[model samples]
Target: MTDAITLRESTPADIAFLQTLYPAAFPDEDLLPLVRSLLELPDVLSLLALARGVPAGHAVFTPGTVGGHAAPVALLGPVAVLPRHQCQGIGSTLIRGGRTRLEAAGTARLLVLGDPAYYGRHGFAATSDIRPPYDLPREWAPAWQSLSLGGDDAPMNGTLRVPGPWCNPALWA
Candidate 1:
């Protein structure tokens, strides 16, 4: 593991890097097309982690609506770090940096389908306080964690809706 890594907002030039890194993290059949579609959404947030100038991981955040309210929530997904870079904090940095940027932009909450053990370090928790649009499997639901930028009272519960092709069931599956 390198002593230092760089985190940045993915630029148009970084699409290739994302394309390369995502598959390494998630070998799902629907991921590539989902990536392509997510790139076109106006509310999408994409980030890249670079180690020694080489892309090591990628993370994507998409705006979601809950319970018919326009809650400024983000759905984090596909946070992928190269197998070699798994435990070196690259994933954590990418997630933290992305959340920081979103919070800076006035986003209120973020939702993620990932390990609570991993995300909990960043103030994420799985509370029955919020509900997603679709029913997530029990195992997956336990991993659903939320982080609030505006404090605990911020509207945290609602159905999550992603724009465009991201709404497809296959991608969420």
Candidate 2:
């Protein structure tokens, strides 16, 4: 049987765990630097999931804004789980935990650029109402999705304003 998974806010102390986690989770991509920089940014929420006291997965949420939405907004990304921990609900636990914290903090919406099939299971739906920081490829447009966090449901037809590190067009592509 698998060990119980525990969720907690990530601290600088977890960087070493992440150094190895991200590389293994995303072998072909170089997302380590981005993940490291995000952890040091103010207003960014990071979560760590541990299995039997060992780091098993992680998720990061960063504040962002849609041009017209008045309430707070956030972006969910760079989430990863160690290869061995792949389908044990750790990723879902991290996401739900993050959503709970953000909603408690008055966040209006949470956006993510990921597999539609996966995020859809978590209540995320494709959204054309709010645009991402940059134009996504036509095929990947469906990957841009959002979930309303019980704040304001008013239409937000504007581009997302992300932080400096997320401004890189290369990352958006």
Candidate 3:
């Protein structure tokens, strides 16, 4: 069996490691700077996953609005697993921790942009009513998805108000 993995609130000390981790985990995406900015946002929730006392993964969740809806929502992104620890369920563990924290915070829904198949496994699906503020390319529409955690209310149509790091157009493309 694998060693028990622990999730912890990220501290300032973890910043340096995350500065290195994001780039290494996403070599082609140049997402390190964006991840760094997100980490510093006061309204964001930053978490780190440790396996056998080693930093194995990280996830960033930031508060965002559904424009006109009073519905509470959060954005999930830039989740990363150390290269050596990938495919070992470390990423999955990180996500579970995020979900629990979000639920505890009473966040009704979560949004992400990625391969639907992957996020779908975590109970996220494509949402038509709520869309990102920016225009996603026609073909990539399916990548913009959301997951309802504890709400069965009617859908709302509105734009997402994200933080500065997420304002960059590159993220939606």
Q: Give the alpha-carbon lDDT of every model.
A: 0.77, 0.91, 0.84
lDDT of 2 by residue, 80-100 (tens): 999999999899989999999
- lDDT tens readout by residue for model 3, 53-142: 888789999998887777678999978988988888888888888888888887878899888888988988888788887899999888
- Which candidate wins on TM-score? 2
Write the number of the candidate with greater TM-score, choosing between 2 and 3: 2
Residue-wise lDDT of candidate 1 within 145-172, one digit each (tens)?
A: 8888755356555567768875666555
Off by over 4 Å in 2: 1-3
What residue runs in model 3 are displaced by over 4 Å at the alpha carbon?
1-3, 151-153
By TM-score, the candidates rank as 2, 3, 1
TM for every model, in the order presented, reads: 0.86, 0.96, 0.93
lDDT of 1 at 127: 61
Which pairs in model 2 have colliding backbones? none
For each of the candidates, the C-alpha root-mean-square deviation to the true structure, in angstroms, is 2.3, 1.5, 1.5
Positional deviation of 70 in candidate 3, in angstroms? 1.5
Candidate order by lDDT, highest to lowest?
2, 3, 1
Q: Please give the lDDT score at residue 41 for candidate 1.
A: 85
